[model samples]
Target chain A: MNTPTPAHVDGNAAAGVLREVFAVDLTAAVGQCDNCGCAVVLAEARLYTRAPGMVGRCPGCQAILFRVVRGPDRTWLDLRGLRCIEVSLPDS
Target chain B: MGIVSPGFSGRRRTADLPPGQYLTDDFPVLSAGPTPRVRPEEWSFTITTETGREHRWTWREFRALPTERPTVDLHCVTRWSKLGTHWEGVSLDTLLAGVETTADHALAHSYGGYTTNMPLADLRDGKAWIAFRFDGEALAPEHGGPARLLVPHLYLWKSAKWVRGITLLTHDRPGFWESAGYHDYGDPWREQRYWGD
Candidate 1:
């Protein structure tokens, strides 16, 4: 079976890139969209990498939720669109 | 040794192509969420400035305005260049005609809640448009139908799809990708793709 062309993918598509900065699985965390107030998992947010970095937009409203860019010496993260992000703690 | 395709050829060359970019015939779809299904009658365009003033135009009203057909090249920060792309839309200059403003920036808001910011100068003098047609056809819903901001000079993300409004500001406020780690000003020629390039 042929898969249709994807305009964008879910945040999980950026897991490998994100792993450089985040110790835990960011795709599994829940994030809220500041625009429409929709709360969903980061894995559900749409992902676009056609640009230089990974952009996670809300699935409900398409509002940007998070952005991660890796530079030569540091990693930059912007999460201003999220009212809150819930990440489960790993077992000790 | 690496295997090469049957018709493998080195990167194609063109005077218009920018650095670190490859040319392609495909128009790849890249969105932040599901494609928004907007009804023609329900669609509208708005422009709001820092002073809380607003100008609104419905679908029909917007189409009644003048439009321009431009055949230009598009460069994605991810390194794809689709040259000679055709588009038809109302120029931002016509939309902002006779409108007074002391603003320096504008945030483009889309139907699906997506937003991107750019300088007010970027939308002037035929620099951008609210495009509704592509390649002589009505834009597909998957490609930001109704209309999308077409800012060819910058990276494609600056061209917000499903665009619905422009909020002008006297100060610079980062939108979507700008706030996120991407460069605030995505100039393909300059290769400003990340936070610091």
Candidate 2:
């Protein structure tokens, strides 16, 4: 049987939502997948927003990288799928 | 209620929205990965009970079963609620008819490995269906075509798109989103989007 491959955009598609929470741009931040330990920039993670929130999956392992849900009063950001995210800081 | 802003023109009335939810006219497509296109001939629906018994149906047999056109509201955990959406499908009750199972929880498995869990109670008594038609048209692939689980009472995520089968479990097991910190029982009214909420 033929199974069509699913399509998705990269984490760059989620920059707008991530910006609502973080002051700095997060698309360039490198996050390590908790499942596979593969690290990639947020912009390279697979992003899906067809549901109620944005779901970012690790391109290497396809495990959830992060999820963002925005409400009228609150925005829920779940990054348990990532072990750690490294964001570049500006040098003083 | 907050004061209306000066010269504010509302996009639409929000009188019927659930807490923390906004009304949306367009049905947004959301998925954890790429859409799966499963041909109807190759498609099958299965129900595996905790007892290890399995009930199966082909696309043709499934379509032959009694079908219903239901108009229901959908609330996504992301806080978007679409009201009065129409669909046609075989009810879970019809699908489960004559199938014996003592399980109280169900994990719906989708075509592309997407899964969601909910109480078996939520799948009964006309609360849910394996919907194949939306607004009088065959469900689109982007919107979970061929057929998708339609559980309007809970958040839309519970309605697994491209649904293929249901496993009746004696105890609840968190599926994809659930294991990733999403609420196990995603009730939009309670604002249960995350684990704590």
| Candidate number with greatest lDDT | 2
TM-score of chain B of 2: 0.93
Candidate 1: list runs displaced more than 4 Å.
A1-22, A26-66, A70-74, A79-91, B1-12
The TM-score obtained by model 1 is: 0.77
Candidate 2, superposed: residue stretches over 4 Å from native: A1-42, A58-92, B1-13
lDDT of residue B57 for candidate 2: 96
Please, what is the TM-score per model?
A: 0.77, 0.74
Q: Give residue B62's error in model 1 in angstroms.
A: 0.8
* lDDT for each residue of candidate 2 in B65-177, tens digit (9 for 90 to 100): 99999999899887788988999999999989978989999999999888899999999999999999999999999999999999998989899999999999999999877
- For A1-92, candidate 2 gives per-residue lDDT tens digits of 99887698789999976565477688988999999998889999989876656889889878888888665566668888899888776662
Report each candidate's C-alpha RMSD, comma-separated, in the order given. 12.5, 12.5
Residue B143's lDDT within candidate 2 is: 92
Fraction of reference contacts reproduced per prediction?
Answer: 0.53, 0.50
